[model samples]
Target: MCTPNDTAVLHAIFNPSAPFGDIREDKDSNIQEDPDLDSRFPADLLEAVLKLELNGVTAAESGDVKTAVQKFTEAITLLPERPSAYNNRAQALRLQGDVTGALQDLNHAVELSNGKGIAGCQALVQRGLILRLNGDDEGAREDFQRAAQLGSDFARQQLVVLNPYAALCNRMLRDMVQKLREPDTQDC
Candidate 1:
């Protein structure tokens, strides 16, 4: 359904802020263009990582998923271990229906964050939505549970569709972790 030059199409979908399912772009209002930050970073290998990030954000906002992906990839190349970059890129991939790519980025973000559970929670929520969209409901549920336990209110909201279930899961998971931490309580 997407052409090779879908970057233009993607850009159009994002800029204008279309409805929830109908992402469209506003090409006329693109007020900013990056001036090659990498070139200024060094005389040789310019690490334009920040510039790439801005481009990624703009392209994502404009519904230009392909360009967003390229921009994010460039940022990753400049800073391979940055967690937020991966998380942001995952969001753009999800918007473009590239659920697999999004999941990969989210997984990488989680791994790079070392379970700090801040951006990791955001990545988990994105992964959960991708799983749900891809018909892996059980996986989606697990991801959402992890995200909610990490204190993500957005993930918790999604879980609350089954309020009692979500609460039970949270309590059980927390108690389990607590017990593990207190070896004396592990018998429970």
Candidate 2:
């Protein structure tokens, strides 16, 4: 999976003084002054994609939603079918208050594979928040329901806070949490 993009991202990361801002800050407004990010690296398609993915993850972890989005976008351009890229982009979008865009990416991530259920549930939580922000309680409720079914405590917490009478959701939440704590019996 090596690609040129990976090399470029490694260069940027190893050089802390590099122009690119980490995800924890506002990259768009802050990055305009940095010049080092303009440099290019020679990488293959897979490497390039990997680099972008790595950058996106680092940016998001550092709290720079815009930078994360940019890196993830670059990754998507190189490999549009990669579910992880879409999921990372969705997270950055969520941090930016762009719930609709995040939901769209989450949908793509979920559609790509069965392993994405947890990630998709996380997306549903963000989508539910956006719905609440937009004054669409019903929409939020639906998203929360899906998220809860997928075993997200955050979703169930929201539901309980929103309505004490949602006992069924509460029971499901408890069951899901219990399931998460059980140790695996299979040994290697």
Candidate 3:
């Protein structure tokens, strides 16, 4: 039996762009300009890591989550300090039904990025979803708030849903609209 929260979460997960849940696909949008990021790694190593991450994403998209995890692991091994691989791995792990592993990797990704980059935003959003599913509304709200501060529209939407007052108001407005659409049937 799905609760109201569960239904809301399902809707958010399925139709996030218009309103809230999935990690944003626009990688560049959440990236914070950090000059040291480029200076810290050799160009060749960065290129290699990018390739591995792309391959991992492809494998995950193809439903080969195990291969995706392997590829992400290889990328992390190559560049342990980079947060992207960890974020990618967390998604694959979640697909593989390894929520604990996914959460751990997400935490690592957020920490590595100092919660200020694409990896951080993605990690936070993903983790927030997981927390919401686990019925940890406060934890989910905190993560979503952090991501919202980083300019995540989905996170902002999640925050609205998480707010009791906002949810009540939204439901009331929806009820009013529904009533307005109904034909009057009372005898004059």
Provide TM-scores for the models.
0.58, 0.53, 0.82
Residue pairs with colliding backbones in model 3 are none
Clashes of 1: 14
Name the candidate, 1 or 3, with the larger TM-score value: 3
Q: What does candidate 3's lDDT look like per residue over 69-156, in tens digits?
A: 9999999999999998998898889889999999999999899988876667888888999999999999999999999898776788
lDDT of 3 at 159: 99
Model 2 alpha-carbon miss at residue 105, Å: 2.3
Q: Residue 64 error for model 3, in Å?
A: 1.0
Model 1: per-residue Cα lDDT over 1-188, one tens digit each? 65524644565455432212112223432222233422334543333666787888888777788898889888888777667578878888878877788888989987876544445666777778778778777787788888767655456666675356777888999999997787885465
Candidate 1, residue 131: CA error in Å? Answer: 1.1
State the C-alpha lDDT per candidate: 0.67, 0.65, 0.82
Off by over 4 Å in 1: 1-48, 162-188
User: Candidate 1: global Cα-lDDT?
Assistant: 0.67
Ranking by TM-score: 3, 1, 2
The TM-score leader among the candidates is 3
Hey, what RMSD does candidate 2 come out at? 15.5
